[model samples]
Target chain A: MPYLIWALMRDCMPRRWWFGFFAGLLLATVLSFDTNLGAHSLGSYLAYVSVFPLVLLFRCGWVLQQRTSQGWPHQEKLRDSRGYKAPLVEFFGLSTLLLIIYVCASIPCWWNPYPSPPASAGYYPVTIHFGANDYWLFDLHSPVPASSTLLLTLDWSQVQNPEQDVWIQDPNGRKLQAIPGELLRWPLSPAEAKEGKMALHSLPKVGVELRRPLTRLEIPRPGMQQGPHLLLLQFLFFWPLFAMLLAWHRRGKLSGTLSAWTCFALGSLAAMPMQATDLDSGPLALLARAVLLLKLALPPVEGLLAAGARMERLAFTSAATSISGWLVLGALSLWLACKEKRPVQP
Target chain B: MSTATALILDNLVLHRGGKRLLGPLSLNLAAGQKGYLAGGNGAGKTTLMETICGFLPTVEGRIQTATPLGYVPQEPLFPLHLHCQDYLTQLFHLGCNRSMNCTQAVQEALHRFQLAAYGKHPIARLSRGWRQRLNLAQAWLGNPQLLLLDEPQTALDPEGMDCLQAAIQQTTAAVLIVAPEKSGCSKLAPLLGTLSVEAPCLI
Candidate 1:
């Protein structure tokens, strides 16, 4: 019984956790034998014959050593002989340190959902409000760069107060510089953004056009842009090249790493479609159901292959909006495997 | 060259870290001919094999092959917690076209390698020897026309090696075994051909 519980905790706990698992299992097994007199008749024989319990205990210990300890039993002394702690442990610790730093740089503290406001209040409080009609549009074009027009399609019920003049602003919180005849209304809406009848706002004469309707504004500091840019710079220009160099230094594992990255790339790409398609209703839900059925009936190998092919076909005709849990799990597993010293072969 | 040549490398040159490993070399493997590659570590034996298997890029070589190739890399890196049966089945299905014949062939190969008991064992729990056998089994799953093995016998005992040699001999496809160490080269069965590292043909 201890072993069964340990097996259940294989990923979450290892040898260090064995004591609690063992005690719990022992209690359960004893209780079972005490309560069920019929099972007790042959229970001793069954318990003696069952090796899974012992195997599970040993396996848990092995996993603990592999996951939490410094090195393999044979490799521990070798590491000490080199006048250092276990290289595997040290490497992981150091990499984890660096990763924490990297993660900190990427943290979107501004996007955290904490500090909820009362229903009547805003988080930071919208600093400005503006409404624009034909007269306001004309004022915007005049003060801005050129002539402008208002192309209103969406129901403006929220901002229908005709008495007040509304300000039109850019993402940087700067008032948009409008050009003459900047707005154009079209009856047919592009399939990209589903909201029909888009209001076109173009910085005309300068040859720049806004692809999407401007409805919201959020100011971005130059420092924020630079933070992401620097992160990208390090990722694209430094870390990958460094990893390649390190791979060469540890030439023993290059092929494995390459294969692992290939799996990651493929999985990430395949996950895109599943992430994009909306599976809430219509034929899409039927297709999702078919995929689910195939997955349950066929082996994972065949199922993944068929699903990939089916997705390829659907990609040409439809778009995906949400990824299945399986793809997310696969991608996360691959990423974790990549961070390890070994390659993950599927 | 006759159509029997399953693979041909012409004027092959490989470079690692700006150092030339093997270069100005040429070789050919006719269909169904079993060949061996013997060399010291870092002598570019694996490099040459990887280039042939299309895993490594070529610097100044032209390799011509007319059939699908199967390769067993020197190291075995199995995914975590996967049962042996499922692992082999995955490899089998990968090589299988919609027919699923390779799936049965994978099972047969596993039985031949004395791994039937471990058919259900998780590959993660296996010893290095068992892992090596699983690697070799994956290569043979499809009975590919061209098979490349890198340090194929590193973890095998004598009998295990003999079983592999038998598989190579029984195969109707061409074989290229990259043996980095020359210690065990003499024990191969009489049917397979051997080539020394210093062969004039490779140069």
Candidate 2:
């Protein structure tokens, strides 16, 4: 993907500038350690961004230097003598393959058949009753076991309306609320709580009060802790698809279209699987499973259930939509690909 | 058959490395005329060509050509990845504002230069003669009203030079051939109508 990006931008940059750019990026990457990448790890992030431009700069500069002194006739001879065009089959086939791989990689495979090992597991149970303006907790328990670490995983759901807010009070009057789009992960060490390393007042008086009945909750457990790893893998798998796209961007209309479509399809596929594969299956699990079930049964069932002409029409329309999407992407890429040539004298 | 002169250079003075190349020079190249500028090695032939091509900064002068002039520099500086046909296409696309059948135009240009066989060829593999032809082809691809050639006679063999000279004479556009040495002048004599660097400067 970076190669594609570099190739696309090679003409826009001058030969002399890219070397130092890439070198500086490499230097920064070398200086940074992966473990040290906290929120403050700007160096590591910049280093990653630097790789593409640097590669592009070096490649373009090398080509420029190798050909500069050859003179006009030499260049013309080079252009005129050896006739070459990327074969149509190679172009389209490679694009199609990359697209498929990209799509497959992108498909979010959220389901894990094997049980995950327990890192730290416990659930927080709470009962609550409704108040005038909000809900008040009736009971709360800190599932703390001695010599073991406790991860507080709260399940928030709207049983009645499915759109209500849920709030919990720590030991202190301070409240921990579950917003519409948020994750809750709290670690409690029994040793610290026993030694009074942290003030009891700091721990909110545990109480669960839902604005409505519990309809859904993201309960964190030993199995569900694998979110980060799964997310990373999902991200990496989609990387190559994006890379192929960036590399082939400047090749021409066809390749550009294929790369873009591949990126889109792969992106959608990867996202779906990643989203579906949670150890903690939320209320949306059924919806995700239904989609997966259709995908699994698509090959044979599609032919048997749907009429041949109907299926053909559906497939043709889907393909047409994808092709059109690629065409638009190609047009945009081409517009951006044609670098404004520097004034010859300058 | 005088159309308003296509190119006019007046009091054109150019200095290279503290030496005067073209000094207070003046000339008028009328439309459709084949003209040449002859001088010694450092006598400002290339400097004059560069100046006319708007590539060099003139010390003191006024020069004008058709709005879209075609210049074939001594050396062709282009990207390596571009093929000959693609290059011609790019030139045709950039040079013209109107929508025309550029493919046919390109085919004709290739045939005219005897480069039809090398139409889809990559520029990196051609020999010197063919490459020169490609250079000329790019300049002629636009079919601009004004054409500028710099030391065009240097790399060509006798037969190749003859073909070039004939092409130059056949061009309908006004042309300025810069040939500084006696060999260059003698070689290009058949194509040009008059040779002068001491003519009245057209202000």
Best by TM-score: 2
Off by over 4 Å in 2: A1-346, B1-3, B18-20, B77-83, B184-203
Q: Give the lowest summed-lDDT range of ten residues in model 1 chain B.
A: B189-198
Give native contacts recovered, as a fraction, per prediction: 0.00, 0.04
Residue A141 in candidate 1 has what lDDT? 10
DockQ of each: 0.03, 0.05
Q: Of the candidates shown, which would achieve the greatest lDDT relative to the real structure?
A: 2
iRMS per model, in Å, is 16.3, 11.2
What's the true lDDT of residue B173 in model 1? 83
Model 2, span A25-96: residue lDDT tens: 344433432334322222232224324432432343333233334342232222221211111212233334
Model 1 accuracy (lDDT, Cα): 0.44
TM-score of each: 0.42, 0.46
How high is the lDDT of residue A210 in model 1? 31
